[model samples]
Target chain A: MSDSEDVLATAAAWRAAGEPVALATVVETWGSSPRPAGSRLAVSATGKLAGSVSGGCIEGAVADAAQQTMRTGSPQLLDFGISDERAWEVGLACGGKLKVFVEKLA
Target chain B: MTPALLAALQAAQAAKRPVALLTRLSDGEQCLWPDAALPGALAEAAEAALRDDAAANLTLDGEAWFVHPHNPPLRLIVVGAVHIAQALVPMAQTTGFAVTVVDPRRAWATADRFPGITLIHEWTDDAMRALAPDARTAVVTLTHDPKLDDPALDIALRSPCFYIGALGSRRTHAKRVARLAEMGHGEAAMARIRAPVGLDIAAVTAPEIALSILAEVVAARRGAALARRAAPAPAAAA
Candidate 1:
């Protein structure tokens, strides 16, 4: 199975177990982003994570947003880049821009 | 996220059929297109995504939907566990191909030589029948023996394998062509076999030959369209 399939399967399992789940996907990338546009990360209500969005640079922020999306059941579109002043804050110093979409999974 | 839709996706994936999951970002309404027969505007987008073997967020009717293409893994079947096969297996694996090395000889097709690669201890014809090379598969014959290589080529040429190569010299390939012709294979069909297999790289070593063969296979797989685009157009008839 592919990485996306594994993440989706895990998210499905979590949802079946009555735990809330959220999926964060890198919808777009510019410059030297570590992961491609379709890279995904699955977050469960208990803080369990599967897959990755950025090679450890932005997973923390994505996970945080994913957890919040799980709690509030709302989607979020996040942008991070070296040009942004908050790039160092989010740890994306790879000289690239990434647009991630986080959504709660039913 | 319905149980039925999820089951369908899993079933399609397990069967090695091409599938795409179209998920609307706004409402998260998901639709799975197992084959080419998608509905309306989505069909064109799904076909393009499948053809490109890429996943993207496409906008249609002013709505955004993520078209995630879930294609089956590409496979490489190498007949003859020679030195080139030894080097080619790992390289093909690293390049995202599920490789299988086939050789009937027990000593040659041993696990000690191939290490973690999949080894088939059966004749080429038998192995080819069992594996059933599809369009997403590539077959390479390195045995240099007509007895072993011809049978594999017969099956590979008949199948939808994207790349078929045979390791031999020009004179050997000429003899092979005559032999295959006697078996009723026409010029067009025989043309598909890349004898003196691998690109025109001045490769003298086994590993270098394997690298050239792999480069040719990749070129055949993904570069055919580009080649067509770059080819000069035929003159128009008066």
Candidate 2:
């Protein structure tokens, strides 16, 4: 299955199971970002995750933000760039920039 | 999540139809746009997105909407389970085409020869009818036998298949053309078949021939516009 389909299916399954779900989507990308725009990551309230917005470079941060979005019932936009020293710590060694939108699925 | 929207998306995916999911990122309002059946409410925006076959953010009436195009995988239908097919099947699959090898010769079209691929043990005409080639489908006839290749070419020529290739030499193709003409197909219709199949790469081996054929198919699919642009301009009037 495609990444979008996988994320959608996982989100639907979580919603059916009475767990709040939030979806993170890569809205924009620059340079050699591992994933392209429209890449997605689905996170459930219980910390379960499916799909990917990055090649493990920034998924942890996105998941944490997604879980927070699920709890707050609000959306958050995150921007990550390799220019930041912290990006190296997070493993974005490809020197690209990406923006992800995290929102609770209603 | 709206169950109706999800159901519609899944239905289109199951049918191998192209679809686009338009989402209003601000509020998570979503709608499904199946190809050629865009909702009247968002016809213009959806049409634009489908044309590009790419996901993009569109602002219509000052609302930001992201259009995610979900296209079905491309398909390749080989009309003969010959030696070339043994090499071609894996190459096409690796290039992301769902391939099916069709041949009535059960002895040749065995699972041992084409493991993990769809093998259709039916006549060329019957199999082509059942598998209905679409715009994203490529049809090739590797069998030199006219009885096998002609029927497959007849169906592919009439269909909207993007590429139609037939394996033969120039002299052999001339004979095949005469037969097709006798079958009532006009020159315009017969022109669709890529006679003497594959690019002129002097390919003699099975694998080399398969590579040339696939290269031609890919060029047909993605380089038509570029090929047109590269064509020499007509002589200027003196």
Candidate 3:
């Protein structure tokens, strides 16, 4: 199965098990982004995860955003790029920029 | 991201249907294209995204929408369990194809030769019937024997499979074409077969041949402008 399928399946399974779930999707990408648009990362309330938005460059930040989205039941559009202040820490090594949309599963 | 919508999306992917999830980034409002026919630019964008198996971000009426295309996994059906297949299978898998090897020769089609691949111990025509090659599927007949390759080609020609390649030299292909013609396949249909079954890379070894074949398959899938077949080597060169 493709990563997209696995991520969606994991998100669905987490929701079915009564654990709150948040889905993070790469909505836009520029330069040499690790993943393409629509690549997904699923985060569960219990900290389980599936798939990735970047090649381990910014999953931590996205996961934190996901948790916040779960708490607020609101979606967030996150922009990450080398120009950001946190670029040294969370920016992609390939120097790509991406926008991730995170939302809780209703 | 309602539970019902998620379930529906999963169901569509599981069924290997081409689907697009359109999300308006402003408010997380989502709808699946084809749930209802989309209008204007959004519809064209979704159609292109699905066709190219890529995602796109479009601004329609000044509202940003992301169209995420979930296309079915690419499938390859190799109608031979030969040496080139051994090399081609792994390469194709690495290139993201779910491959199946169909051959009745139990001795050649054993797991010892093609480990971890779906093996069908049946005639090529019967196997192709059951597989039902779709637009996402590619069919390659590596068996030199006409009995095996011809049947598969006949079936593939009638289906919507995107790629059909047969392994042979020019003379061998001419004979195969004549036979297929007798089998009622027209000239247009016969044109679809990529005989000599690879890019003209002067590949001699089995692995090299496999690489060339896989390259051609990729080219066909991407709708690349394939180079015209190179003429056979000059007789004086021999």
Candidate 4:
């Protein structure tokens, strides 16, 4: 995972340009997860992103979530708890649950 | 993307600093995972195998490992409530350190005394338990009292805090050595204790002493000592 400085810096630049940005943090993790709790990846309204929530599988979805947060100006808590249907979607073999907290900040 | 993250992580890793990433994953109003409860762990054994199917099966440890490219903060535990600690705390914070201070003395160990510090008004063990001191943690005990100093030294010697120092005069330090020996501490462990803490700067004031101590801590952290300027040919051995 990358440092938050770049993410914060870009977010500041976005704010200066009257663009919205969101910060996502993994406050807590359980079982076995790729990233530890407190990992952050920030996204801007312009689709600029820094850091990663998951190794790779989750960033695309998270970037999507970030854009949603930026547009609606509302935060979301996305869960990757595998459902029966989810089994066919992507191989989330790890039984550990990821409680991702996404938020937008001024 | 700014390479700041990689730079910071690489710098910290090279300097032997333990760094943790704090992300803002989701938030109310505008959030990534709204209603996301913090689980603190994730597991995916089946997914791992399936995903590997695409890129040739490779054995990977199922046990949770730190995410690649993620660098956590190094934890430094300062076990004294002294003036030197006051300055050192802020400096450590500025330089990207997760610092904690433990002291039982009421007058010395109060939150107000250390505004932004993770000041703990408890014994060393309790704080260490809650925080779980790691190898990247550096333990510095400044109080001369055995009550505050000894137990901390005990915990630090056993734990992985790279730098462990206790403040004392040479005589006081010698006495401390004797006491630890009496208490069944071996020489090897005692080696970890840096008595007469701080560099030999002959600092007489609090701030100066603070600078000396932190200078040593910085050096110890980087595994480099401030190179002493060349002496003038040693004066021909006097």
- The per-residue C-alpha lDDT of model 3 at residue A8 equals 90
Clash count of each predicted structure: 0, 1, 0, 59
What is the lDDT of every predicted structure here? 0.83, 0.82, 0.89, 0.62
- Residues B58-174 of candidate 4: C-alpha lDDT, one tens digit per residue: 123332222222234556788888888887787777666778888877799778879967778778667666766666677788877887788778777777777777888767777
TM-score: model 2 vs. ground truth? 0.69
> What lDDT is reached at residue B197 by model 2?
83
| lDDT (10s digit) by residue, model 3, range A15-56 | 999999999999998999988899999999989989999999
Alpha-carbon RMSD of each model: 6.3, 6.1, 4.2, 14.3
Per-residue alpha-carbon lDDT of candidate 1 for residues A1-106, written as tens digits (9 for 90 to 100): 5676777778878888998888888877889999887788999889999989998898988888998988887788788998777678988878899888888876
For model 4, fnat equals 0.16
Q: Judged by DockQ, which candidate is best?
A: 3
Better of 3 and 4 by lDDT: 3
Alpha-carbon interface RMSD for all candidates, in angstroms: 3.1, 3.2, 1.9, 13.0
Higher-TM-score candidate of 2 and 3? 3
- Scored by lDDT, model 3 comes in at 0.89
TM-score of candidate 4 versus the correct structure, residues matched by position = 0.51
In angstroms, how far off is B152's CA in candidate 1? Answer: 1.7
Q: After superposition, which runs of candidate 2 have C-alpha atoms over 4 Å from their true positions?
A: A1-106, B1-8, B34-43, B47-52, B199-208, B224-238
Give the residue spans of candidate 4 off by over 4 A: A1-106, B1-68, B225-238
Clashing pairs in 3: none
Error of 4 at A24 (Å): 21
Error of 2 at B111 (Å): 2.7
